[model samples]
Target: MKAMTYRGPYKLRVDSKPDPVIEHPNDAIVRVELAAICGSDLHLYHGMMPDTRIGHTFGHEFVGTVVEIGGSVQSLAVGDRVLVPFNIYCGSCFFCARGLYSNCHNVNPNATAIGGIYGYSHSTGGYDGGQAEFVRVPFADVGPTVIPDDITDEDALLLTDAFSTGYFGAQIADIEEGDTAVVFGAGPVGLAAARSCWLMGAGRVIVVDHLDYRLRKAEDFAYAETVNFGQVGDIVRDLKFLTDGLGADVAIDAVGAEADGHVLQHVTSAKLKLQGGSPVALNWAIDSVRKGGTVSVMGAYGPMFSAVKFGDAMNKGLTLRMNQAPVKRQWSRLFDHIRAGYVKPSDLITHRFPLDEIAEAYHVFSAKLDDIIKPVIVPAS
Candidate 1:
């Protein structure tokens, strides 16, 4: 099998590796059909995530056919085409029983916070990801949802992470009807969150970013107002002005560890590893929302201490809600939305790369070249 191997910071290659076999009775071996490079993957790619070992594959958003399965995997079969959730969890755990699969206590024994995440650094779970010809899926019965007959492969891929996360971001924001919602960052997750705000009855939606291309996509795809943080003098103040001086009712920070608003913050957090992640976008979220409003964090951040505006959030009585989205939890609503033609997740695909050229694919996405929003990886391309 050929897998994308991470050598070190910004170094990757397609290496021939041994094929994964079923290691548990409930495990399944999926032959990767389509995979995606997620923005959070950039955290691991840039050496921000701790314990991302060399030779480990880095991909979490993927859909594939089950080529083989263990005997106890009753929910799936060898021939099933499946949409695997990024979360790897035991179905019987306390967290899983409460529908908090992303926080399953039975997985990732070393971590007390997030549960097992496919292809993320060992901090989440050391399990390899699906950025290859095949991947091993643990607790297969609880994780992989068989792709519905009406769904496309690309759409299913998005649900594995990005789209589901976006909807979750909106869900946790608790947007009231006629409320104004602001989403920071214009990446795939942020774009989806902006679009979802309309479905959640937000009166207005605004997306903030520094890139013209992404901001343009936010307008076209999300039907939301766009603001380039670079053009605005003070983003928080500008957001207040847009919302008639009070502030947005809800603010979502979709830009995480690698946020670029503050040069010093970016350098210390992303480059020097002094802080967990840059809190520029998050701080802005805290400062931009109306008093007693909500601030939802959908971005991926390191476990280290960030300079978040906790004092301000407390002073303003803001409701802070966030989590690593349990991808399967959002599927029912997402499937209905996709089938009804509300939003086509595939529209976010700006580029595609073959597994052989995955290194180049990572480079193009990491560099933000070619107006890339999301890039699909074809294992058989």
Candidate 2:
């Protein structure tokens, strides 16, 4: 089989590799139909993630068909079309029982903490990912959710990660009807976050980003108002203007980095930072929120040590929720949303490339050129 291989920094290639087989009773072999590139994959493309054996297939968001199943896998069977949750988890683990499937202990024993991710890094389970012909899905019964026959693969693909993470971001924010929400960054996850906020009944969805193309898409799909941070001199001030001198009830830093190094002021309430990346977003959130506000971190962060201002957070009485997606908890619900025509996740996909052209797909997506929002790689049928 020809799989996309990561040689090193700024290096990727589609090369022949051995096919995967079911290695555990809870595992299933999925023949990938459509796999999309995510912004987090940029960590691997830039050599930021811990070392994986050469040729690590780096992708997590995908929808596919079950090719084979392990002896114990019963919920899913051959020919069932399903969306694989990006995180691998065992239903029996301590975290799994608590509905914290992303922190499942049994799936990735090698992780420094509790989490099993496909093709993230050696520190993240070291499992081969879906950016290939086939992928081994552990905890198949608990991970993959079946999509209705009427649902297109393109539409269901985003549910694997981006949409799930976005929904989780909104949920953690505890948003209520008529509350205003702001999302920083216009990447796939950010757009998804904005959409989820709209679904949560937010009165105003403000999307912040430098790119006009992405901000435009956010407006089209999420019905979000756009803010060009590059043009706007200050984020907090602009946010205030947008919110009628009051800060947004919920502020999501989906960018994973501080918004231009300007300290966001707590206006009328504590701000929530839904940014994913490193723990640095924590301090940024503390600075941005109004008193007694929430911060939700939906961005990906791995084992890295950093200092946080616990005093500031405690002083403001901030509510902080930071972690990866509990994919299984919302998998069925998200699929139903798709089936009901409530969310058109496939609209987020702007580019498509054949599996053989995956290397170029990475280049275009990582470069963010040509107005690319999300790129999906399809195996030639």
For candidate 1, lDDT tens digit of each residue in 1-381?
999999998899999999999899999999999999999888788777778999999899999999999999889988899999999999798899999999999889669988999999788889999999999999998999999999999999999999899989999999999999999989999999999999899999999988889999999999999998778788889999998899999999888777322232321223343455657788999999999999999988765366778999999999999999998999988999999999898888899999998989988988789899999999973
Output the worst ten-in-a-row residue range by lDDT, candidate 2: 260-269
TM-score of each: 0.96, 0.90
- Candidate 2 off by > 4 Å: 257-286, 303-311
**Local distance difference test scores for all models:** 0.89, 0.77
**Clashing pairs in model 2, backbone N/Cα/C closer than 3 A:** 269-290, 270-289, 270-290, 270-291, 271-289, 271-290, 276-299
State which candidate has the highest lDDT.
1
Give lDDT tens digits, candidate 2, residues 1-381: 778998987689989888898888988999999898888787677666666668788888888889999999889989999988888887787778999888888878676465888878777888888898888898888888898777778877888888788888888898889988777667878888898897788888888777788889999988899987668676667777766764677777565532211222111012334322335434545555666777777766554344567887798787877688886676667778787778888888899999999888988876678999999999766
Judging by TM-score against the true structure, name the best candidate: 1
lDDT of 1 at 39: 91
lDDT of 2 at 224: 91
